[model samples]
Structure formats: C-alpha cells, structure tokens
Target: MTWKSLKTVLASLVAVALAACSPTPSSGPEATVTVFAAASLTDALTEIAADYERDEGTRVRLSFGASGAVARQVEAGAPADVVILADPIWMDRLAAAGRLDEQRFDLLANSLVVIAPVDAAASQDVFEALSGGGRLAIGTPESVPAGAYARTWLQATGRWKAVQDRLVFAADVRGVRAFVARHEAALGIVYRSDVVGQDAVRIVLEPPPEEQPAIVYPAAGAADGGAEGRALLDYLRTPRAAAIFRLHGFEPVA
Candidate 1:
C-alpha cells in the first residue's frame, strides 16, 4: 500500500481498537451504597453525600429517620450499606445483633437546645418560658435520641416532673421543630442545626453537656454491604466530611 493509504488504514484500526477497549459511559459505580442516617443529619449529610458522589464516583442513597427507627429497620433486613446514628446506644444495639460491622467509629457529637416561636420574647429561659402554659414539644422518648436526651436533661434539672402536665411527644426531632414552628407548641427541644436557618423559632437555652448524655453519632458499615459500604465509611472520616459535620453543629470526633 502507498504511505498515505497505510497511514489512513492504521488510523482507522487505532480508532476501532480505542472504541473496543473503552468502557461504556456510566453514571457511577457498579455497586450502590445505601446509608441509613439519623433525621437530624438530613441537611448536612445530604450535602456531604453529594460531595462524596463527586469525589468517589459512586452513587450514594441516604435514608434519614429517628436513630432508633433506623436501627430497627436495619435489624429487620433493610438494605443499609452504612449506618450513621444520632445515638451510640441504638448503634450498640445493632452492633450487638451483628448487623453492623465491627469497625465502628464515633463520627460526631451534638448538643440539645430549647427553641421557642420566633415571635416570642427572648427573656424567658426554657423552664420559666414553658411555665407560660405553652405546650412543650419533645421527641418521643421511646424512639428519638434527641427526645431521650432532652428528657434526661429535663429530669436532671428537676423539670421533668414539673413539666409533665404540659409535655407533648413527637416522633422525631423534626416533629418537635414543626410543632414549635407552627406555634402549636410555643416551645420545643431540637438539634441546634434544626433551628439554625429557621426564622420561626429562636433558640432559648442549650442544655449543658453535664445535664445530659453526650450526643455521640456513631457510624459503621453494614455486615452485608461489603467493600462499597466500607468505602463510604472511610470517606466520612476525611477532613472534608468532618468540616461539614462541624458546620452543622456537630463536634468532630478526634
């Protein structure tokens, strides 16, 4: 063949070989990671997952709810690749049942704060403010870590018995925020992050760390989710993810 002809033929073969070797364009990983996290982490974790998807080239699906509820679902065979819980107690339950892998870490910590309708005056503390006969909303002590922590704080402050008559229980921390936001309850206890951007409620009191159990968020891969699960767990340990958690009011796990 002439030189130009041979060059053209070689170029065509190279093009064909390139096409044969290249993998098909795809959206993400072959494996999908399903992360079950606490409802309080909704805002922060959503953004973090988006960043993780960008960084790792994987698709991450997040399920957020009360920590206790999430734990129960995972125990019942929910397809969770990773678990990020608001309370270590619920996580421990999963660990004891062997649902979560043994390589767990305390990812973050949070504190409880009392909020009141934004229109309300700021002079009143949580205790005296609730004395105004306003409904007091809290997470359900049975299934909500925030609610459980809030209850412990109140009882420690000697307000549980005194506030019993005015108390209202919500299924989750968001429920408590909703009640206060709508003015259905003048006051409620929720995560600081929950009330951060909300103009409908104002934080009135923050429970001292000594008044309640430290709100530690523990994370681990599910026993069945394998390498993809562990990859997600590892991603969360990165400083970028830790910064996001800190911005959302969580204390970074050292």
Candidate 2:
C-alpha cells in the first residue's frame, strides 16, 4: 500500500480500538431513588413520582405498606433510599437506628374518619354509628399508626370499652378500608386520604376539630440514599407535590 493510504488505515484502526475499549453509554434513567412510604400516601406519591421522573430524568421506586412495617424494614437493612411515614413515631425509630440522613421533616397531615359501606345510612355521631353489633374494623393498634390514632380517639370519646368487644383489627389502614368496603365489617376507621377515589365506602363520621387526633406524616432520606435520595425528599416538599397531596385528601406541611 502507498504510504498515505497506510497512514490513514493505521489511524482508523487506532480509533476503532479506542471506541471498543470505552464504556457503553447508558440509555436508562439517570438515577433511581427507592422510597418506602405509608399506605395512605400511595396515590399522591405515585402521581408525584411520575412528574419527578419526567422532569429530572430519574426513576423512583416506591414501596408502600404500614408505617411501622416499612420502618422496621429499614431498620433491618432493607435497601431503601427514602421513607415517608404517616406517623412521627416510626420516623423516630428510623432516626434512632441511624438509618436516616439529617434532612427529616413533617411532610403531611391527615384526619381520622369513620367509614361505612356505601349502602349504609350517614351518621354524624361516631359512637352511635358504631353502636351496632357488627364488627368495627381498625388497624392493629400495636403496629399501625392509623389504628393507634383510632384507639386514642375512641378512648378519648369514652367509647373504647363500649366498642372493644366488636373490634376487628387489620394489618394497615388500607386493610381497614377494605374491611368496610367489602362489607366484612359494618364500619371501619381509617385516614381521610384512604377513602379518596374509593366508591365502595363513604365517610360516615369525621371527628370534629376538637376531637381529631394529631396526624402527621414525616419523611427523611436514608443514610445510604446519598444525593439522589435527598433530592427526592426535597422534591416531595415542593408546591407541585403539595397540590397533588391535596387532591388525595392530605394536607401537605408547609
């Protein structure tokens, strides 16, 4: 071959070798943030995750369950990046275990309500509505925040002893809603957010402001979450996310 042609061929071979040795460009999301959240925040967070992924080019992996269950999972070293819980008690446990970053805050608030099957008559009085012999469903008070709040409200209203015999305990707030929706229980106590978009059950009683228990949702980034997890935690506090939470019947914390 001619000298000029040989030189060109050698240069082309060198370029091909370099290209083959270089790392392949990724076509997937820029990063992924795994979140463990309370069951009550399911719909709102799912909507917000879509917006975050589109705007930030990152993926959000969500796992929803009872606040206590997810908190215990994080403590057991489950690979979670962020945690959003319906109660502060569980968040405190995570913080004590050193599983969370310093960036923790109360993210949202909700109210407790008594729900009944859609066919049931509306009742304004919580105690009277639950006076029937039929079962009254609630979350398991020991592990579920919603249940604990329900129990507190019942006790405060002087109805705990009256309703104790008829109580049906569920694994989570969602389970309580399901019990009422499926007619497995005559009535159920759950978060206001849990009934949003649900047609099978309707709110029969909403505790007055004076009687309502303080319901707060706290969020934090896991120590392993690094920058991406912290970013997601911040995004959840934005105005856009607040609007979404409002649509789902939750009050976003300012």
Candidate 3:
C-alpha cells in the first residue's frame, strides 16, 4: 500500500478503537425508592408517587400495610429506603435502635371516627350503640396505634369496660373499616382518612376532644437509605405532597 493511504487506514482504525473505548452516555437519572407506607396512606402516597416519578424519573416502589407491621419489617432488616407510618411509636423505636438517618417528624395527622354499615340504622350515638353489646371492631391495641387510641378514648369516656367484651379486634385501622363495610361488625372505630372514599359505611360519630386521642403519622429515612431515599423523604414533606394528603382527609403536621 502507498504510505499516505496506509497512514489514512491506520488513522481510521485508531478512530474506531477510540470510539469503542468511550463510555456509553447515561440514559437518564433513573432510580427506585423503596418505600414502606402505612395502610391509611395508600391512596395519597400512590398519587404523590406518580407525580414524583414523572418529575424525577424515579420509581417509587411502595409497600402498604399496618404501621406496626411495616415497622417490624424495617426493624427486621427489610430493604426499605423510607418509612411513613400512622403513628410515631414505631418511629421512636427505630430511632432508639439507631436505624434512622435523622430525627423523624410528623408527616400527617388524622382523627378518630365511629362508623356503621350503610344498611344499618342511623346511630349517631356511638356510645349508645356500643353500649348495646353488638360487635364493635377496632385495631388490636397491643401494636396498632389506632386501636390503642380507641382503647384510650373508650377508657377516658368510661365506655371501655362496659363494651370491652363486645370488642372485635383487628390488625389495623383498615381491618376495622373492612369489618364495618362488610357488615361483619355493627360498629367500628377507625381513622377518618380510612373511610373517605368508602361507600359501604357512614360516619356515626366524630369523637369529641375529650374522647379523641392525638394521632400523628411520623416518617423518616432508613439509616441505610442513599441520597435518592433522602430526596424521596424530602419530597413527601413538600407542599405538593401536603396538598395531596389533605385531599385524602389527612392534616399536615407542621
């Protein structure tokens, strides 16, 4: 081959080698934030996650269950980036174990309610209905925060002992709502947020201040969570997310 032609061929070969060695361009910033959320937050978080995914190109993989159960899963080393719970007790436990990246804060607040199946007689008097000794559903007090609140309210109003025998305990607030919705229980106590879109039941009572216990949903980043997880936690506290929480009948805690 002529010298110039050979040199040209060698230059072409070098260009191809350099092209092969170059790193591929990144498609985009895509990540998945694994979140464990309380059952009551199902609707709101799912909606907010859609917005987040669209805006950040980050997928939020959510797992919803009872707050206590979800907390236990995290404690047991379940791979979780963020946790939003219905109560702060579990958050405290996580903090105690040094499992949180920072101090947790209240994400949302909710109120207790008494509900009855739609087909049942309208009983505005929850205390009177429970006093009648029919099955009354509530979350199990030992672990479920809502159940503990219901028990507290019952005791404060002097209704617990009178109706304790009639109590049909459930695993979570959603379970209590389900019991009332399916007509499996004559009455049930659950968070107001739990019954927002449910049509099978109607609110019978909104507990008076004296009977209503404080309800707060606390959230925090898992200790092992990376930057994406921290970003997801911050997003949850934004005004846009707060508005969504309000739409779901939950109050944002300042």
Model 3: clashing residue pairs? none
Clash number by candidate, in order:
0, 0, 0
* Residue-level lDDT tens digits of model 3 in 130-219: 554579999988778889889999888888888888989998888899898887889999999888888999888898776678898988
Q: Return the clash pairs for model 1, or none.
A: none
Q: Which 10 successive residues of model 3 have the least lDDT summed?
A: 123-132
Under the 3 Å rule for N, CA and C atoms, how many clashes does model 3 have?
Answer: 0
How does each model score on TM-score? Answer: 0.88, 0.89, 0.88
Q: Top model by lDDT, which number?
A: 2
Instruction: Pick the winner on lDDT between candidates 2 and 3.
Output: 2
Per-residue lDDT of 139 in model 1: 95
What does candidate 2's lDDT look like per residue over 1-254, in tens digits? 99999999999999999999999987765689999999888888999999999999889999999998999999999999999988899899899999998899998999999999999875555456555568999999888999999999999999899899999999999999988989999889999999999999998888899999999999998878878898888888888888999999999888
TM-score of 1: 0.88
**lDDT of model 3 at residue 15?**
100
**When superposed on Cα atoms, how far off is each prediction in RMSD?**
2.8, 3.0, 3.2
TM-score of candidate 2 against the unseen true structure: 0.89
